[model samples]
Target: MANDPSVAHDPPPYGAEVFAFSHPAQTERLDSLGDLCDPATTADLARWDLPAGARCLEIGAGTGSLALWLADRCPDGEVTATDTDLRFLSRLRHPALRVLRHDVRTQGFPPGSFDLIVARSVLCHVPARTELPARMVSWLRPGGRLYIEDPSFFPAASSPDPVVRRLGDAVTTTLAASLGSDVAAWARSFPAPLGGLGLAELGMRVHCPTLTATNAAGRAWALSVADLLPAMTRAGALSEAGGTRALAHISRPGFVDIAHAMIAMWGVRPLTRHTEPRYAG
Candidate 1:
């Protein structure tokens, strides 16, 4: 989660504009769901034991695209999509859909209220990630499921480009550095936390570190973020010198290969699950 006190981030710049996605021309990828994290998420659901009528709760429900997908999947079930922005609520319309402005960092739901919970690309932005697994369990009934994803970016010891090095250094050494930017390391703690939660039927998958991001659209998105570097530095989410340096490095020729790694984790509540260790015996 955002450990930096210095980085100030408002929500990741969402507006009324509808997002457009691009895909690569050729197919060399192992799993190409293409554009947005939803495809990766939906593929994972294919492996789970969720029947047709399972209820779902989605955190960080950006743009309502994923919620709509889940609603279509579990047509017989209800899908609750929650986010901090009310503007996003304007885009949703589904019979089994419900939207709310729920910020987990401030408050949470009662235990055993949801059958399935999903938070993609979200754990790192929370103020702290300590209570997450237990909270997932708290929101699940017995036999329920939880899914989470995050980046575990660490300072690279070596980078050919000076600019890349600066961005890497900030993310690794200072909490104030990644203030609103995603925390890369928090989600890698996954398998470890799965055991701690006493969750059974646990499994996980690690996706590529370099995404084709070569497609013109993905390239534009990267450039768009790069364009926002100045504002980010001013907002204190990144240092002026460091953010500019990262963009300069990423913009170089053939630099579009620069990609972030994605990790996925899943676990199920034991039907017979009982006592939780508040502390050691």
Candidate 2:
């Protein structure tokens, strides 16, 4: 069903040209992102009662950290890790894990193919963000859970620290301009639509971590900012001098601020056809 030629060919904002899988710093950036977010992700997943034989899907499984975790957690189960680029995922080895190069926008899975589905920091970059949840929900078996985590830069965007604010604004502005990224709105409003999607037992949480220069979040932010600097400067979202100053400020030991809030929303597909899903907002 995913290969249907009729599906719209909407490209992602984080395509190879903008954030290449071949970039030398990509591995490190992904690693830092995993270090920064995996704990919270795992904790949230642990809330569900996943069975040993569960069939799991991790969309946009960058670097395969969470996919490997699922493989370990569900040793007798099958885990499909998919990404548009597979270079990082190719390095992972696990008998229960299978890696595939897949695009969520243009491709899909058969209905009820998985028991659990998760995507972290992935959908926000997709132009078809609104349509993806239903597509993913269609892939889950009844009673299966869908968990999505995306970043809301509202905190950082309005930081009291001038450097942080400027950097955050520049990053969001450039991404919105060049890539059509939602930046904050989609993530902040994520929970509202799930109730209408035939899912039950909806829940939501937010993780706002403090970022210091040497911390994982800080490192990941710095890497991403560095990668986007050229485009940001070119778009006049950030000046050359401002970029330099912001980077310097972020690397200082005393520099501390709130990282973007990772908003996590989850819901379970109704076991019965007549079940009315309630919004947990």
Query: Which candidate has the top score in lDDT?
Result: 2
Error of 1 at 102 (Å): 0.7
Scored by lDDT, model 2 comes in at: 0.87
lDDT of candidate 2 over 1-281, digit per residue (tens): 68998985544348565667777998899999999999999998887788669999999999999999999999999999999988899989999999999989789999999999999988888767888898899999998999999988999887888888888888888887777787788889968757688898788889998889999999999898888888898889998788888888899988889999899898998888755677664
**Candidate 1 worst ten-residue window by lDDT:** 14-23
lDDT for 144 in candidate 2 is: 95
| Local error of candidate 2 at residue 74 (angstroms) | 0.4
lDDT (tens digit, per residue) of candidate 1 on 6-113: 885554322211121121311212012235355677888766666567889998776676788788878888999987665645567998898988877677888888
**Top TM-score prediction, candidate number:** 2
**Runs of candidate 1 exceeding 4 Å displacement:** 1-34, 154-162, 168-182, 209-213, 216-224, 231-253, 256-258, 274-281
What's the TM-score of each model vs. the native?
Answer: 0.72, 0.93
All candidates' lDDT scores? 0.61, 0.87
